[model samples]
Target: MAAVIFLVAAAAGGGSAVWFGAQGWGKAANQSPPVLPPATAEVTRQTLTATSEYDGELGYGVATTTTNRLTGTITGLPDVGDVIKRGQSLYSVDGDPVILLYGELPAYRTLKEGDEGPDVEQLERNLEELGYDGFTVDDEFTWRTAAAVEEWQDDLGLAETGTVELGRVAFLPESRRIDGLEVELGAAATPGQPVLSHTSTAKAVTVQLEPSDLADVKTGAEVEVELPDGKRVPAKITELSTEVQAGSGQQEEASTVVIAVAELSGDKAIEAAAGYDQAAVDLIVTTGERKDVLTVPVTALLALAEGGYGLEVVAGGTTSYVKVDTGLFADGRVEVSGAGIDEGTVVGIPE
Candidate 1:
């Protein structure tokens, strides 16, 4: 079998490119070159990744406000980006350390020996990990629990009272990166006043998608993020949710948007985002993909006279058309296969 060739061409046939069939190629082989600007594309092998970009922002994830639980003057505070770890002062009120403790329980009442609940268990757990001994970590606040609390209090140069005062500490999980100071230093620290805010130190991107786009943005789905400086980084969707956003009034429409968080994986995106605490990034969410397929310029497909589509192969100034089976169409290209088509086949694109 001699090498077959095609001259692809199309400008108005169903708005798609047409190919000179093998018979047509044979006819054009001995003829003069067609009077048209030469425009052609090779039969290239590539994976067509169907992706869509959405507006996104880079930061340390969602921010939640930390409130002051004591009545005093705010004396000291940590700056934004400061990591308040376990057993450290989140903020000082009247010179007393409002310590950071790890727990899920919200400090409601003063935890003393007589108290018996999840808050006690939470305190005991933190104490157990912070080198306090001789106490069982459970919901019951026994004397041993009070002993541990007093030891911790004494270590912090506070009163060695057996009770853990509600304002003496703030409960958080592990550690947090201070995001903002909600209340200024020297301000009166009133109960329930927003003292500061914080978020996890990890870098992440958040995207809000229209309801129609939610299907492709699933939790755990892998994605790519383009930073403000044009750096691309691979990321994974760590969270996804659909919630109704309340409208201004009862007459207004309550819109539902898909909220997703994508965790960035490399230092490139991070470095590009330096000095930007919260900045916009573009998200390329791959919605569909096909690998190792024979593809050509979507315009290369000719709505053939014989029916279906074809591509024109050009060889030695001769052009012929070969009918092709078309598949996925994306990015101005279409997946194609046929009897005499392979990668490297130069197909013409009609101007």
Candidate 2:
């Protein structure tokens, strides 16, 4: 039985099996590194620097709202977006004086009401031109005035409350009236109806910063704004709010901030203002420049068993792991600031 077992084992080639396997493994290990080409890499130098970005908008530096003081239908006036200077006459009210109900009429009221002067006429003309068709220029609030008021209220969707509210007059739409806000036209508003809106006069860029980066922001930091049209506007940081906004996904809670008072040079200012209202703002507050410094491909810098970093430097056909002090890392190259590693040194990547 022992002889028969030996014959079967020999046929199976017991000794040859281990030897062939070892030989194949050795050949594979030897040729692996060279067979697959060493990853070709380039080295560069790092420099210390700062960069800035302005994430704000470009618009008229000042935004303002004009309101309708009297309840009336809109009449003749410049179309929305007409630029006006201070003290420029914009819109006028009609000549029909609105019946101002006073709980107690004063002795002076009779004289003032009857005084039909140019001021009242001018007010009427202005109001008529401004779309206030509720009153005639006869300088008195008559039945026709009431009819016009009701008609105006119907057009503006306001309740037929004839008594004017001064607040309603202050909140008129200067340009295109939006639907979401409280100050809407075509609504029957009384005296004091808020019809106008005002926002930031100047255009600015708004951006949200990650919480980790919030500390880096401050007022008066120099910033650069890049427009989608490839235009860059330089500006100083004007404000930074500490309010943190929650992110929707993948992003952490961040703070949205606005930067104003941008310094746009020449026609670039006009170019920036053209589409800045809806433009995406890229704010850069850090400035960086490329400089010549000792740098190596980041992969070469390995964490050594000891402290510091290590790299395989090939010299005279011999490779040695040399320790290196790394500096700033940029452009895929680590700034190497140590001895033993020089420029153009052929380094071997680990097996």
Candidate 3:
């Protein structure tokens, strides 16, 4: 098949310059001598990846604040950076420990034998994991459930009330590393006050992006993290969240930022980030990719006198224009395809 050639006149400034139009080619009277471009490059078939790097921080991802649901004198507090797990004491209030339980529901009310809800089921699951048994883990709390709770309370050296009081247990999604202490030891622990802050124990990199950059970012996408020491490691996007950042001045406007959390996998990735408790890193996310496709330098593409784009193909001692469709543009190269474009084909680079 013959390739369609769209001939257009070169602009007055130079032989490589061409006029842009909405419909058809320019008249032959507008043509100029030396129609070929001064510089030429050969089309090659290769994989092209369009990626963007953003500033990120390597740490334990995001921190969440734990508030006090019980009122008492703060007897004990965990040190900063302490890793607290399930069945462990998060903090002490009035000589009683606030046990840590793994669950998504927050402790809202006093759970007694007659109580029945998802919160009850959550508590029962934790209790079972802590070695308490002889009761079914269900939403309903019965006498059998109270027996197990009593046993747990006894093990924790608490009063065998058989009823879980509000604030007796703190529920978190997983084990957490204590980030900071909001209250000091011996301080008064008031209800609804922040007691401590913590984050997941796993290593992660967090990157903030503007709204416009979020179009290609999705969960489970693979990315690369460049550590402070110049070492690169692989990571995957596990979570995405939105945060509102306050402006510095009264006249400034608050902006909504998307926070991407990428979890580090394997021993190498974990060990590479272990040295830095919190440090700046670079997150390289691939936005687009083209595999085994013919590509040319972006400069080779000409804004044709017709509506679309064209490339001046140089073959033997002659040159001609070939209409081409452009794809992923990355690293100064663009994916191009047309009837006459192929691997090793020489294309003119417009001046």
Give candidate 2's total backbone clashes. 59
Model 3 TM-score on a 0 to 1 scale: 0.86
What's model 2's TM-score? 0.46
What is the Cα-based lDDT of residue 223 in candidate 3?
91
> Local error of candidate 3 at 39, Å?
4.4
lDDT: the better of candidates 2 and 3: 3
Clashing pairs in 3: none
**Residues 51-108 of candidate 3: C-alpha lDDT, one tens digit per residue:** 9999999998988999999988999889998999999999999999999999999999
How well is each residue in 51-138 modelled by candidate 1, as lDDT tens digits? 8899998998777788888998999999988998898999999888899899877788888887888888888988998999998888
TM-score of 1: 0.76
Q: Tens digits of per-residue lDDT for model 2 on 170-261?
A: 22222222212234334553444443433433455555554455455666666677777776676555545445466877766764643234
- Best candidate according to lDDT: 3
lDDT to native, each model: 0.80, 0.46, 0.85
RMSD of candidate 3 to the truth, in angstroms, is 5.3
Worst 10 residues of 3 by lDDT: 16-25
